[model samples]
Target: MDDLVINNLSNKGIRTGKQYLEGLRDDRNVWIHGRKVQDVTNENGLKSCAHTLANFIDRQHEPKYINHLTYLDDDGDRCALAFKTPKSKEDIKDRGKSYYEWAKWSNGYFGRTPDYKNASLMSFASASTFLEKGIKGQGGKVMAQNMVNYYNYVRKNDKVLTHTLVNPTYNHQQGYKGKFSEKVALQVIKETDAGIIVNGARLLATLGPLADEIEVFPSTVLKATPDNIPFAFAFALPIATKGLRLICRDSYDLGKSHFDAPLSSRYEEMDAVIIFDNVLVPWERIFMYGEPELCNPAFSATNAVVHMMHQVACLKLAKSEFMVGLMTSIVKASGRDKDLYTKGLIAEVMQMTESIRALLFSAEEQAHEDQFGNYIPLRYPLETSRNLYPRMYPRMVEILQLLGASSLMATPSEADFANEISEDVEKYFQLSNLDSKNRVAMFRLAHDVAISGFGSRQALYERYFFGPPALMASSYYDLYNKDELMERIDSLLSE
Candidate 1:
């Protein structure tokens, strides 16, 4: 009886493209060209996406998922995907399992679903309880309120939220020699009676266009200084705010037919280059300001790293499981099911999927309680999985490409099949006993997963997506107790 599908989001009182457009027409901060984006919810590219994501949130209202997919916060309202700080270890495991269930259903295509933000925000709430003295911007009263307010808003009304964190450019070391030492980063250009006005830019906001709301936070990439203090602020704003222009990266679609560019047409969720020109952050919306010391550590203290690692790892595992299933199905379809070599390859894919799942499970099961009373995934296994996933994912793609053979490249476009030349194309490319369309779909899906721009971006995202590898490795070394391991060696030597 529950409308759990992506398209059935209307029953939950979510605003459509039409409604969202009306809200943005007056927002001065948002611009697509010299002209302002009058109606984001109704725009050519932005409308469909905004509606699609709003529909996703509406699914949380259905009875079957309403219980497992959402939870009641301190205010006694049921909020979907609002992070539930586990009171016990089971809570941590349950949250991971819940996220995995969602990913399995979506096939991992909906990466920045509301659930992702909910979990991270929940962690922030849990961690804020442990604000010891002088721990940078330790006692975050506003962050706590922000989490609750945003959760409440999204719960009652279907609101789409996106976040912009990282600094705009990475070439700063070579480009800004004098400014770097003097803190030439996006510093506080000016302060105002109402709030601070910031000038500079943030990079790679991912889900900006689809979101109704945008949360700006200081990413770890920006080093703090007195000059960079203004840049250290965090605030929330409507996506259509004036002076906020999104310069999207080059389209990866390349005008290829949808069949050939399957992932690009639908899975192009990542957006880059969020430019801010004298953007104002209202006092109520500002969670942090001028406390440059708190920027990096404050962002980290939310346990966002562990949350993202868990979130994506679950999605990746789900995707890998689907991939393994498809490969096995294809092997059978191609009548190579009995071939020992083919069976070995299928088994290898299954093994990789299982390994990822095992790591995820280990991270969940061994989660420890943080000082804030929120349970965090065991850092070592989660970090290990995060580090290993980037490298292993590319190898997995190679495996798919290899198994696909030249068949992947030889597939005809959907238009070709629909045209009068269908017979000729079908005759040449039809595989062992399979229909032409079925074969094309299989190969197209493989290409989408293996070699397309979407696939390449995924590889890059996996690598630097969750912060630097060296930092991850360092955190592993820092959080891990080396003394425990050494004690075993000491015992053996003493004996």
Candidate 2:
């Protein structure tokens, strides 16, 4: 049994929050506002989130949450529940419970939790046989076994991961279809006995700064041809690996009081464009490479896409439920709960939340065993959730704006109450049900979700969370049960 889950992790139990933060003090290249960040644990904007994620990790060790967040492995190590492979329908349901719990902890604002990547790794590693079908990569031929080893390593060590899937395109149309530009996109520049040397950049690693490692997987649109061979690969690397750089966008965490910028203060999972300056990906780190045809359907064939979708559906459900709570709270505080229009607005959000809940249940309830002996939640319902959420989230934000009206913007800052105008602040800002201080706190959270720079970025992030909506819808159409439905229509037409 000691050999069941292999690895030599420092702790045989879940690591503490402090230990998690200590991991981020590495030599990883992270830049903000044109200057290199020396330490993510102490930096003004990034440090807040670095610590916030650490807190999330610490929850796994708490007496109250330990059982919910983790389980003891056969090897005697208490591991994260996220790494558990679903062997039966009951296992699928249990995984869903853990996934939803993780999402709800952050109130759905923290988009890239470690469990999200863990789910993908679990699926790929479970179906490690699929990787064996690909052509021998430049790194070597043991890609499938490498995947299983990588999964074990991450699980035993409890590593936080970030991933980038798309290459930045100068010419949009051509670049996205795996026609990566030599100078701009991340493509293999050379191969040696050591490993493959990669260069150029990839976009949208949501937690790049805080992650211990990064999964550089293939873009969904990669084409199968000699021209695209350099771009067809998948591998993981430690964030501290030499020649890897994360160029971040401006941070939304402006070092504000939690009362003033609730979500922004604590949930700033920074997005960055990754630059790989001839980084060496060792043979053991390479999961698949040199087969674009294999790369395109790898996720689907291995059932990784379905598992990732299950995680996402749970996340979106939590997010939508949070909006419903925010809206209902706004109405209760403002004494608008009895108003017909207010009830109507809040009910709409409730419906969207329920819609997400229904889809998640549908996916899980319809779980089936895959060729790899993994019981995966059905992909269709989860796919529907993914396609619908990017559209639903923006409207959910809008519902907040409509309900809050001027309250979302006119809220006083945390500083206003402590300064000389304390009396004035309390006197003027009070609502019918909420005192001035409480009112400000609630509305500031709403502002962070609906009106602030953080809010706008969230809107944009949701809009394209899984890529262009049109493209997603097109693919959904392609995957729909048209043949079965059309057969019934043909029978009716003949009658």
Quantify all predictions' global Cα lDDT against the true fold. 0.65, 0.87
Native-referenced Cα lDDT, model 2:
0.87
When summed lDDT is taken over every stretch of 10 residues in candidate 1, the lowest stretch is 1-10
Weakest 10 consecutive residues, lDDT, candidate 2?
1-10
TM-scores of all candidate predictions against the true structure: 0.83, 0.96
Stretches > 4 Å off in candidate 2? 1-13, 136-141, 176-178
Candidate 1 lDDT by residue in tens digits, 69-101: 777756565655445667777777777877887
lDDT of 2 by residue, 1-495 (tens): 121133445555567789889888888899998899999899988999988899889888888878877888898899888788889888888889888988998888888989899989988898988888867543333888889888988888888889998888778767556577777888998999978999999988999999988999988787677988999999998888889999999999999989999999998999999999989888778888877888888778888888888988888888988898888888998788999988998898899889889988888899998898789998888889999889899998898999888988898888999999999999999988989999999999999999998999999998886778887888799999899899999999999
Model 1 C-alpha RMSD to native? 5.6
Q: What TM-score number comes out for model 2?
A: 0.96
